[model samples]
Target: MDIILTSLINLIVFVLGAAIGSFLNVVIYRIPAGLSLLYPPSRCPHCLTRLSPFENFPVFGWLWLRGRCKHCQAPISIRYPLVEAATGLLFLVVLWNTANPVEMIGYWALLSWLVALAFIDLDTLTLPNSLTQSGLVVGLGFQIARGWDNGLNPATVSHALMGGIIGAVLGLWLLDIIAFVGSIALGQTAMGAGDSKLAALMGAWLGWKYLLLAGFIACFLGAFVGGGAIALGWLQRRQPMPFGPFLALAAGLTALWGETILNAYFNLFFPTW
Candidate 1:
């Protein structure tokens, strides 16, 4: 009975997350387009047909509609269902990682922001200052709550706070330097302001030490994927690729495995510390 109840709860969380993902899709697509997210309701971009309640059932709705607008027969972007599924999976992952309700809710909020940023950056290649600032505020609140709940030593909290600040400063400065150099070499902007804001946001959440890990992982992943695309002749040398998604991916991974990664590094270097 207990097992069944747990499974049911998980299912409910997944469904709720999917619903939130559906709404996030609105924010992601409409915000970049300069459209009001709430005013017109969800409509077919091709036909301007407003989506009915039955047509708006998150992942299932898209699948049931066969990926086309009901009225105009226009094909919908696969991102709708994909985003919903991704959010659902992330919800489960966060629950699994943090059993504490407070921590779970906090991380849920954090991941939602990350999801929104991921899509917005993919669409516009820009991260709105609004989202970044909001995330920073939320992250600080989470840190404080977690610190208080866990009875962390003052020194640990101090370290974490310092780490967060250093992460933001270093991430921004490093990206700026890279952008400056790239502009000189390529004679154009190679990085977007969104990527910088994203790095700072990640820093605020994960702190400086983990930010380094996340950035390194993102760069490595980007190189691997980009190189593969180049080798397949799918992308040319000068093709612009958005880096925010990769950073988000790295941040997500780090959020899950950061402590283990950090501990391993410490074991390798300090051994007794």
Candidate 2:
């Protein structure tokens, strides 16, 4: 009975995540175009036909429609359903890992932001300030609220605020410095302010220690994936690639397993400690 109940709850959470992901698809499409998220009801981009409720259902809707619009028969991007499915799975993983309700909420929000930012950056090579800036504020606010939930003591409150601030500064300065040095080396803009903002958001959520881990992980992923793409002739040697996706992936991993990874590193290198 307990196992059944747990399974049922997980299913419900996955469905909820899929629904939110559907909305995120809307945000990804509209935000970069400077459209109001609420004003325009979701419509087929090709035909501008407003979708029926059944047609708007998450992953099932794409399957039902056979990956094409009902009215115009225009093919829909598989990414829509893919995003929904990925979000559902991610929600399950996060749910399994986080026991506290508040922490779960924070993790969900962080992942959601990362997903949207990742896709947007991939599509446009620009990360919207609206998402990153708002995310930074939300992260700080979340930490402060978490501190309050734990206790109203000054130590807790100060620590929460200090940690968040330090994390944000660390992320911002680190990225800014990298961008500065890279620009001098390459004689072109190597990174954007948007990337810095996204890093700051990561720091605000994960704290400085985890943020450093995330940065290292992102650098490693960027090199590995970027090199693979170049070797495959999919990307040019000089082509500028978006780094937000790697950063988002690293932040997500750090949020989920930073402590484990940190301990493993110490165990491997400083076993006595």
Candidate 3:
């Protein structure tokens, strides 16, 4: 019975994640256009035909439509289905990782938000203040709620969360500072304020120390991909690429495997773990 119930719950969570992914697609498209996500219903960019409810059922809908608009038969981006699948899969992973009900909700919400943030950053090279700021606040709330849920000391929880917030902001600032100096040396702006905010927001959830792990991973990814792009002549040495997606990706990965990696690091160097 427990196994069946768990499977059912996981199915429901995955569906919910898909639903959120659909909404995220809308947010990603509309938010950067300075449009209200709720006001303007989703439409095909090719024909401007409104997508019917059944036609908008996330991944299955995309499959059913064969990746084309039902009204105009215009091709839809394959990225839509991929994003939906990724979000659903990640949701299931988080559900399996989380034992607490509240933590499950919090973690899923955080992942969904990150999905939207990442795509928006990828497409538009901008992270809307709405998503990043809300994620930060919600993450901090989750931290406090976790402390209360576990019956931990209020003072300790407060101090720790504060420390996380401070650490993330300072960490982001440090990255920006490095970028500023690099720009002076390299002759182009390499980082932006949006990435700084995203990093600070990540700090809210992972706190300062693990936020370092996220930053490190983001930097590595940036270096690897940027180097490849440069080598391919797809990008100039001074051209800017979006950093928010890398930061979001790093934060999501760190949220999952950060402690394990951090402990391994400590074991290797400090013998503390």
Measured by lDDT, the strongest candidate is 2
**What ranges in model 1 sit over 4 Å off?**
152-163, 185-187, 264-273
* Residue pairs clashing, model 3: none
Better of 2 and 3 by TM-score: 2
Query: lDDT rank, highest first?
Result: 2, 1, 3
Give one digit per residue, the lDDT tens place, for model 3 in 1-273. Answer: 999998998889888888888888888888899888887687888998888988888899999999999988999998887888789899899877777887788778778888898898888888888888888888888777776677668886787668667766876686788689978988877677777778878888778888888899999998999999999999988777988788888988888778888888889999944
Candidate 2 regions exceeding 4 Å error are none
Off by over 4 Å in 3: 1-3, 269-273
lDDT string for model 2 (196-247, tens) is 9999999998889899999999989999999999999999988999999999
TM-score, candidate number 2: 0.97
lDDT of 1 by residue, 1-273 (tens): 999999998999899889989999998987777878788988898999999987998899999999999999999999999999889989999988887887788778878989999888877778888888788777766766666667668866666566677777777777777778878998878888778878888887787778889988888898899889999999897888778889888888888788888899899999999
Could you tell me how far off, in angstroms, the CA of residue 83 lies in candidate 2 after the best superposition? 0.4
TM-score of 1: 0.87
**Backbone clash tally (model 1):** 0
- RMSD of each candidate? 2.7, 1.1, 2.0
User: What is candidate 1's CA lDDT for residue 33?
Assistant: 77
